[model samples]
Target: FGDGSFTGKGLYHVDAFEAALKNRIDENTILSHDLLEGALSRAALVTDVELVEDYPTRYSVDASRHHRWARGDWQLLGYIFDPRGVPALSRWKMVDNLRRSVTPIFWVLACVAGWTLLPFTQAAQWQALMILSLFMAPTFDIVNGILPKSGDQTPRGHFSALARDTVFGTALVALKVLLMAHLAWMMGDAIIRTIYRLFVSRQNLLEWRTASQAAKGGNDLGAYYGMMYGAVIIGVVGLAIPVLADSTGAFVAFFFAIFWI
Candidate 1:
């Protein structure tokens, strides 16, 4: 709304809309897709809205933008459940919004839980299997994309292509997962703090600022590369863990590896 990314386009009555903004909506709410869409949906104005091609053109810029949007979604989640005078949104709509709102939280928790559980499981086979699965999980889509369609290519050609795809895809996936985990951790921490300030401590939302503009200037890139390097270090340590002949050494290494996750 501030950047002309969204416009009313004369779709609703001007006076009613202005009154809603002044009285119903929280002025301090972060300008976000969820806030706008949720408010409109709750008001039963589901039609005549259009999404424009206003996305950032660069990957770095897009990532930075999404970082903020992720926080905004978390903020919206509080609004969804608050006792404040939000309109009666449909149950299905609320559930959908809640899922979208908490995606980063869920991802962060899943990664942390996966890492936390790794050390406790007694079965060595299961541990190895889980590691292998993480490595292989991101390759399925690439393999599918590169596979030759029926009657389209030679079997040998498909096999060669698949081998190449697997190699590249696995590396890319590993990098992406590690970076995403780091970003999720950063975002999740911010969201948690914001929740604590806004709801748990009963602070005024208008006075709260979870992240300052200066802090965000380079965190997106920094977190990505920092996590990637950390993953590499952890992977090296994990590879060396199996070489330790003693069960106690292996056990400690196992916990260390899990802690890395």
Candidate 2:
């Protein structure tokens, strides 16, 4: 590709590589395309190098390094590529992710403290602050983007990105809170829909048509029974929330919300 030049061949090759990667990865994989793209975009922005136009410099790094050093470079790239690895809590990578996510929570707490000390503060204001803290979970993503644990050579750019991500993550969490509140208000409908689909609809459309006729000469009681039974199941789910289950749910929900939005 023009000896690492960012001309015709190099640009085409870069695009092809990215496209090929998109085709290869499973949509459900822990290290997803979205995560990779975000990481790379931040990398490029922080490095002050366009992936295409800056190819020469990066290739120079590759060329200058000892053959053995390639392993470390590849490992860092691999870690960034893997979702399971990027946000990994058991390693150094997690330290940055946690730091980024927690920064906003700390900021919010500081604000709450100031508010508490204010002469005009009241009980209602404190209650509002408590509700606001619920969205702290999403703030981590902002922190991750801004202060990525995967330290490359972009400290100044990282802080700038961190500031940007902090604002964006806060906005995203605010929107999610609104959506969750809406969904929670209609939590009964969600329960009903789950019951109908899982226990009622399938039976009615397939085997239960004949069974309903034989049992009562008319309507199928499975839907009603299923709905009743589902409530119990949902209640069990509610009970599971007291321990590790809720924490897991919160992590999942935070990511799911971020991805969809």
Candidate 3:
């Protein structure tokens, strides 16, 4: 697709070559990952050459853009279980994509569980364990995306590395807490839609939907509020679990949910 137009995030970073080298691709998929997988299977020489990409600005545009991407990445799952010529690194990347789809769901569950279960459950240790599992899954992904090689640069001691990852991870998440809930909803929707497609309607897996904003702006405030209504409602509902039933253990979760609102 980058026979060159400033495409979205991943496409701009695609590994491309002329027609002769392009013939290495097995499937005619739109995703750069798919294309890269096909090329890598055929032993193509690869290198990193950064290029400028046009990041989507409008929220609707950005969401629609990533929705297409989520579909594309999910489509790679078939290769994961039945490895056919895909390299080890590429295969693991497919597994990582699966984790990405589920990570948001884990985040939502963590917030809900921390707010509700952690406060009232007598099995305090178990509840905290579950909450930590759900909470840290998204944090690991966040930190991984921000610094893929972070593990290598950590101090030599094992405990020290973990402590640093947690401290830095919490601070970083707090900075983007506002967007975290939105991302959780968006990626959760992607996971649900992907599941439905896998079972019910296998067609249109490759369909690409671009965000359209052809109409000129007038009172975008109404449109803006209309879009955010769901988020506001979710924040209010999620907060209720901790706000009304506040406890010592739930305070951490409550504090996070305030920014989430």
TM-score, one value per model: 0.47, 0.28, 0.58
C-alpha RMSD by candidate, in order: 8.5, 19.5, 8.4
Least well predicted 10-residue stretch by lDDT in candidate 1: 1-10
**Native-referenced Cα lDDT, model 3:** 0.57
Instruction: Report every candidate's CA lDDT.
Output: 0.50, 0.37, 0.57
Mind giving the per-residue lDDT tens digits that candidate 3 earns over 36-70? 44434233323475767667667666766666677
**CA deviation > 4 Å runs, candidate 2:** 1-126, 142-152, 185-187, 197-261
**Of the pair 2 and 3, which is ahead by TM-score?**
3
Query: For model 2, what is the error of residue 26's alpha carbon versus the real structure, in angstroms, after optimal superposition?
Result: 25
Q: Least accurate stretch of 10 residues (summed lDDT) in model 3?
A: 1-10
Better of 2 and 3 by lDDT: 3
For candidate 3, give the lDDT of residue 178: 59
lDDT score for residue 34 of model 2: 33
**Model 2 lDDT per residue over 1-261, tens place:** 111111122122466457545643333322112333333322222234355433323311322221112222222333544553233322344334334333433443343343334333342354356547756665656655654677684888778777777777778766544333222322334334333543456322111122223233222455433323433443233333322232333332333223222
TM-score of 1: 0.47
